[model samples]
Target: MFGVAGRISPGPIGFDVTMIAVDQPTVARHGLTIVADHTLGDAPDLDLVIVPGGITDAVERDDRVLAWLRDRARTPTIASVCTGAFVLAEAGLLTDQRVTTHWDDVDALRERFPALDVVDGPRWVRSGHVFTSAGISAGIDLALHLVGVLGGPDLAVETAHRMDYAWTPTIPEAPEGPQRGT
Candidate 1:
């Protein structure tokens, strides 16, 4: 999704993305080995921080990662994909906020973070500067939404078009709670 943002015509959307990890040579759940660009201590200040979802039980237990997230909470935007919401909640960043996760794990998120308003259905939810999305593909939608917010609607549309993705322009509005983001 972000690849589309960095490869648009006329000019690329300006974003210098960095991948950080608690440790180098991290292996994903599916046996994918990822060599991170930086460790938490070495990462530069970021305007936006995105936490990806997968098997996060281990991450939820890592105090170092949680502490790093807490320290980076002052970033302009913090987002999570799927069950990555659990990590954010564990770090106390989702307190008193409405959030979402993979539909299969919605109950778990609600149970674990009783203080949060765990809503289901929306492809993504944006409360204040924190954003949460449902499942893997929803992260793409959230990414596009962020591109629209950080860049422009037109740029987002163009990026979507370039990627051949059917992008939805509006965020679903819930009957109660804050207005869904544009």
Candidate 2:
């Protein structure tokens, strides 16, 4: 969905997106072969950074990846989906920030980074220049929101309409009391 979000073009609100990785010829968790067209050393100055989550442990253990993220944390916007929040937290970019991730990993995120204000039940959360989303599909919603912010609400709506997508702009309130573990 990162590709989809990056390709969203509603009139003049189009984005020029590029994919980068710590290494080339990486395999996705689902067995998809991803050829890294750009490495961190070759990345252009970026206005936005979106980190998609999978196999968080491996990403956390890669010093090169962590250093690259730490360098890019100063970008205009940085976002993560699902377990990608772990990467941001590990990079010290999420300290004292309210964020959310896949519901199943909320507790783990909080435990791993006690300084982070990990929110629950929100499809997405934005604190300063950082954004995070719940799970897979939620990343699209967060991207649309970013589109609205970067382009305009009209363009975002147009993009969603063109894609036949249902966009939810508001975060719903979580039910009171203790939440069950996923």
Question: Top model by TM-score, which number?
Answer: 1
- Per-residue alpha-carbon lDDT of candidate 2 for residues 82-112, written as tens digits (9 for 90 to 100): 8999998888888988999999999999998
How do all models score by TM-score? 0.90, 0.86
Native-to-model Cα distance after best TM-score fit, residue 9 in candidate 1, in Å: 6.2
Show the lowest summed lDDT stretch of 10 residues, model 1.
Answer: 173-182
Model 1 local distance difference test score: 0.83
Off by over 4 Å in 1: 9-13, 171-182
**Which runs of model 2 end up more than 4 angstroms from their true locations?**
1-13, 170-182
Q: Give the per-residue lDDT of model 1 (tens digit) for 105-171.
A: 9999888889999999999999888999999989999888887777667777888888898988654
Colliding pairs, model 1 = none
TM-score of 1: 0.90
